[model samples]
Target chain A: MLGAPTPVLSIGSGSAYANDRLAPAVAMADSGRVSVMGFDCLAERTMALAQIRRRQDPSAGQDERIGALVPLLRGYLSRGGKVVGNFGAANPDAAYEEFAARLRKVGLLGVRIGVIRGDDVHDLVTRLDCALPELGTTVGALGDRIVSANAYIGAAPIVDCLREDAQIVLGGRLADPSLFVGPICHELGWDLTDWDRVGHATMVGHLLECGVHSTGGNFEDPPYRLVPDPHNLGYPLADVDDGSVVVTKLPGTGGAVDELTMKTQLYYEIHDPARYLTPDVTADFTGVTIEDLGDNRVRLSGARGREWPSHLKVLVGVDQGWKAVGEMSYGGPGCADRARRAEEIVRARLDAFGSDIDDLRVDLQGVGSLFGDRLVGGEPTEVRLRLAVRTPNLEAARAAVHEVELLYFGPAGGGGATGSVVPALGVTPAYVPREQVRLETEVLET
Target chain B: MKLREMAYSRSGDKGDVSNICVFVYDQADYPTLVEQLTADVVREHFGALVQGTVVRYELPNVHGLNFVLDRALGGGVSMTLRVDPHGKAFQSLILDIDLPGGRR
Candidate 1:
């Protein structure tokens, strides 16, 4: 007996931001209309960092913010509002155990928590006989340097867990949109093979996946399309039934939801409008249309879908050596000139030291750093000199940082000299046959 | 007039590629945007920041043109030494393009 027209709310969007999203989640839950609340906390770099944490501590790797979020949602859980999230970045089992303990501590007992694992294919990645389409290299060529490899699993496992009466679902390295799609599929009982319905649902998931983005958080026309009470911005919600969705937010909350806002989010991070790939289906947004339904609500429809791809996209994190960046600001007249001199001095120092830096860059931040060789008009009163270097050896990276620190003593008006040397992790995109990876789901009770 | 007077833009990045979408507020401005905003014009506008090819995709339903710049962001956010590694600020550059209509 699933809710036919399920109202899904997106609570948290990015990776562990400081804002208190729990308050809005509580508000949406108190309405007694939301059947599911999904949190998307995993990003490309965030997953890579989670993998590093997992290597350091076996029990860790989940989003730390989940520890604080679930306890606050106990009231909602008691009200029968379900939760699905990818806060279990690299360790779903460990995250589920920790979440269950927190739930019991808060006196919210007997809550069934479902954990979805087996997305990680670090060991099996090297054995795959396939070449990365992006880099044109075989998986075997990557060899032992691959630290973490996880496929973007879809919504089927999540729907499966919800069918078993699990109040909460946790997954690791799953596609972000699937966090929203799972609840939709479970409530609607839409077949995975139904490309049209799946695609429409996926479009809804994408609109709500970023939480506040669709609700005017990062809207383009700012002052014209004002978002009232933006500091306390409200998250987005989708009321869905069949294949249609109405995108809206909690009533009387901050942020505006309209056609412009929805349009911007629709094209966000999307390369091709016709072939937006996900584990569930190949969503086609070309024919999609949006209509303002009034009062911060818009109707989205006509999203078609094709068959799912034969291979799953896997993100692999590899150690790419060490990188160091140092910066110092110069103020008052002739600041750009002073910054240029500082850069020259640092480059001369590195050159004199016989440094074997792989990629070295020096730029005046206030002048022409972002545009590269393209110079902007006029001079600035203040400029910051940024020098960055990548080296195979940590000591060399530190030496490069030291060179920028030396700028304070040599160059005039040089201040705020600071820098950091950290191990660099580069992401390599790969593909693996869908059958090569297995998705496992387990229900745990408190 | 500047392009911002007629359109709004948003930029995003994937690997080393950066895509900027310029959406016209008025439907009538779509043809003008398509005519004035070509791949060559975008390449010249971005200059050296984009070392590779620039391809444009038009979405008539939304009155939008998406410009994909390759080899941008130096080498993507994670590896690039750029201050704006995500290329989030690049939208303003595209919006600053001059228009023939003069402040529509």
Candidate 2:
């Protein structure tokens, strides 16, 4: 309940996804506009990939930028600026360890760091045999092939941590918007169960969670929609009041925060504007109104909320094995024809592997790699023939791409040949009872 | 005319689903967009690329239309071997849709 009479909470965006540029985040921290900054460092597939890394090395799966980030965050933490992020990725304890060590190294003693756990429901989903709707099977069906299962958690643990005076909070699979929602609610005295207030906070969180997306990172086009300083686009910050918020970026930073930018991001990944399902609340953004305040500021309001969903959505990571990709360029007058011939040769060669290769695709880059025949245009002067394959066996994946390398001797005029294989992991969604997840937040003073 | 003449779009992915939102640059064209860009229309425009259902949601207040295409990506983002896994290019591909009454 620590809020001024006016009660405006200013929170800024730190990082949008794993490996997001640190310079912009540093800029936001030093700008002095926000007292709290939320960083969303995980995407749908990010956790699965992080899990793969963890499987290989016990201490390697957390966000890799913490070492570089901690020194950068020193000034902000000294000024009493709070930070929250899903930097835990697949490892919350490792993230906490790194944060503690780094903060102590920087002489920032007495900083309270909160570590949230229990989002990992791999064992829970397995025991419950949760149904994986996308995979058309149960978690038990996947057996040991299922690598990890992490629930998309809400702002509840974050609020709990903040209530205990955590200067920094990090967790695994914290829903992107919840990173901001917790801070806003915690700072403004908004109750976690207050649906409308949480919804309003969620709307503001959604706006800033994507970092530069709310500003202008992905809004630029050559002629139709253009923003200034796209290369240096700044992350968005929100001035949140009770029912409304004004989202804007730092001064003179690239990108705009006008009505169009706000509208596009508001519904960017949202399927239904009226009912955006998040762990915190069933937020309704349909009634939201956007007003351009000029100079990269947009005021948005009218977000309502209903009761939270009883079931929580969990991302189950399945061991998809390996994916191999090989490409070769064919140029000149008969490039498309030569590329097709190259594809035929590669296909016939790949047929020997048979069922070892699960999914096989051969496409000409400029011809029909994307959109298929829907948008395949005229004959191109040059096109790259790309052969992609997926398999449970890495040897088969490597051999499949090795066939592409053999193309140098098979097809005429095939130049600049390349081949590579990488471990692949697929993530699917499953619903579990919310009560099944028991979040534990431990606050540590450095 | 193509929808590109009157609107802008962005596509995002959640697992195998792709949601592409289109907002008209000019508010007057919103109704026409709603009338012409139905789920069926967008499905047909995408053809075999979209193996599942197409759902269109209207944003009247913001003059926008959101199209959620199910099983649109070749599996999920990391699983899909397609050059554009997340359908990041779908935004541009959607602009190529034919809108009969769009302003040139």
Candidate 3:
């Protein structure tokens, strides 16, 4: 069965909680005779969300969905398929254990699983903390206010999983694109030394990393026209053979996998195509080409890449403290003028009373208030003025409200009260690349 | 360490800043595959690729490297329309490298 190579299938989601969003794609893989299933999840936001959930419900700790997502994998496994994913966020070991337990309960005994680690590249943050040569002029602007850092993990560890005969592999905090790239190299028997093809696979992985983004779900220019269903969009699949790859989606699904969509995705989250960075290598995206093969399919080939350095970047978040904001609207002739005057009064009041308004910004909506009157862009006439302040002191931040009431009596004050004050959240610390977190690769008897 | 491609865009008025995430991996025979695999080496490698003014930092605690390739991609300080969009795949192409274990 493994000889013909059951079309290798993979799925990627934008968030950790997108299990439902990723289900359709997984289902399609099963129906299309896919042998292995993998998920991409290096989203920092997802980690933050998982942290919140862990704190609230200790039982629902890390790997919150192993029981949920693994069962689907087991169902496929029952049909002689395999599953793998980077469901491990801040804690991959914990996720792996949970997955193993889930499999044990389902009677999938002796399921050899592997966990890939050693990608926390936070040491660079210290160097960056002292002096960052890459940021140039902007380095001084940020000062030492960076919260977290993390190194982008690559596909080498995934290959380790393949070597161990693992039916399933889990990763903690790996780059989303790496999930797709690893399997392609494994299936095609492509050598890691083959930088060109590996880079091409990485390109394909990047295109579909955000799940439906490449399939025209989030596209903008009268965009991809992703058919059948856009809201409940289906993820894409890269059916490859020889030296080429065809991007497509399942039948009776929603999404466009054509040249335009691929092109749009290619340019989405990229900064420099010439030196596209990852945990693997510096890819040359400009050297690649794309072709639309009709039927929601696009063929990608002719890509090149280079060797990576010896470290990973770590992203970390720190406790930045709390903030609160309140907005009030003003309409009429001098509404814009009134908003500005009110803001000045509030600032003066807070400043006079010993309030900790470390970061204070009041935005005038209707009247286009540019950064120093260089009004190049913005809504010409804003009707609402949003006044936001970030302070360590909660009482002081609340006391600033006095300034809002005074605005009504000012020159532009035409409002009584329209909106309520919204409290900003206490920022949490998110840490990035921190030491090479080690994981021993072992073939579990299960 | 050369400019393989240039993707610029005027997405918003948020200046022409490109956030580069360099990937560095360990050699196949390396004993401890730490964050070092994706740090300084990756940054310096790509810093050369863009052929632009560059700044770099070593995230020791994170075991990775970061580089800020400045004025590299094309974009306008104003206008939300990113006249040039490099897309994420472009970055993947340039940073593409081989795996340690070769092909499975």
Candidate 4:
């Protein structure tokens, strides 16, 4: 806990949904109340896709959102609002170079940028002594098919970068919540061993990490329609000091930040409430409490934490051949029956070709496609038949599309046929000793 | 009354596991939620979608119950061919469950 509290604002949440977040973030930064702004743009497979992009072109591994977001944040950067994020994805060095160049082009030169590295442990994965606990397989089994492997690093290096007076910090594959936690630790001077404070701050990071989710983005039960100005939903912010954090959004922005929204975001993607594992510490959210302070403000407290883990969690992406999908709709009377016949015909034709399909699924769109064969009864005037398949080779994957196309020739009424095939990237989790990975920071100036 | 009338929910996925959180509107209904919404009930409610075990974590202070369903979401967000790849829609699915004796 610090003598004075510091406010950290979260700009972007998920990778794909981050672009729309800049407006609200800039709006908040303009108020001059936030000390630091953090952006969490990397998901489990984001680095895998980024690595593929880098393989194609040596300088293409950075999160593309940075290019658009930097210009929008130029005013904030000039006004002394610090920034930190995992938008570096698979290549922090390349991302830093690109960002510096973009800044210079916009005449916002001389901004100090820090790049944190060493999250990529692709070379050490096979030699590591640990194994993937979930799959019951050793790292050696992943072989040469592994494209990218990164350990989820904590906030120490990020704090070190901040201490060096870096205006912007770019990181590769750091833990999502650490983006926010790093700033809090740097500002409040909280020790890593302060379990209670760290735990309380981690909850604040988790709530703000998803941006609008804590501010009414994907909130459905209360029905988003009731949320004020749902179209212009605000991003989340945390006013943290003395281990106590109050969550709220920009004052005039459109969104609700009550207890319901906070609770929903608290449990999002967490496996165990008692033991929420991370590189920094094993946070226990079970003892946590939330108080609705009215308006859009909620207060969170009582989050307890234990010691940090000996091993860091890593995500490994392996090339898994190709996947193909095709969809067509059947309408008018007996649409469901016609859709079923179309599926059977496509399955029989694909089987006749003897294609080496690893997995094949035929689903009736308006029926039970999402739940798989659990159809609730109702007569539908139209039904779309969707065929999806995965195969070890592109030839087999393409054969699935060919079979679905034949439906137009024989099926009674099959229209709107669309298909696509792309290489699949499969992800698996592994654990590696913390000592095996070294985190280093580099400062670059425009 | 439907569970949606009493509670609100939010869900997300990590690998093949999907977690859905149900937060009752009133703190007084926390006990009823804990007793009625069990692992077995959620596993049965999800049916074939959940191939493995279902674990429920209770947070009495927040009046929230988190249901972690294993082997759900077809495969996961990146690998799944389903329309709702991240299983974000599952929150509404679970919230639609029927509750006995109406509001607490």
Question: Which portions of model 2 show Cα errors greater than 4 Å?
Answer: A1-5
CA lDDT for candidate 2: 0.90
Per-residue alpha-carbon lDDT of model 2 for B7-99, expressed as tens digits? 999899998999999999989888899999888889998999888999999999999999999999988897789999989999998899988
* Model 4 TM-score on chain A: 0.93
DockQ of each: 0.59, 0.83, 0.03, 0.67
- Winning model by lDDT: 2
Q: What TM-score quantifies how close candidate 2 is to the native fold?
A: 0.98
Against the reference, the lDDT scores of all candidates come to 0.79, 0.90, 0.54, 0.79
- Alpha-carbon deviation at B40 in model 2, angstroms: 1.5
Clashing pairs counted in every model = 0, 0, 104, 0
Q: What is the lDDT of residue A95 in candidate 4?
A: 84
Error of 3 at A221 (Å): 3.6
> What CAPRI-style quality would you assign to candidate 1?
medium
lDDT (Cα, 0-100) at B73 in candidate 1: 72
Which number leads on TM-score?
2
Residue A186 CA displacement from its true place in model 3, Å: 1.7
**Model 2 lDDT tens row, A107-128:** 9999999999999999899999
- Candidate 4 local lDDT, A1-446, one digit each (tens): 66653444333332223244567767766766676888887786566677777767887788887777778777778887888888788788888988898888778988999899999888878677347655566667767667778889988888889888898899888787888778887888788788777777688789878888888888743342368888888888878866567888877888799987888898898989988888888899998888899989888888889988898988877777788999889998999899898888888878854657767888888888776654376798888989988777788788788877778985688898899997777666788889889989987788
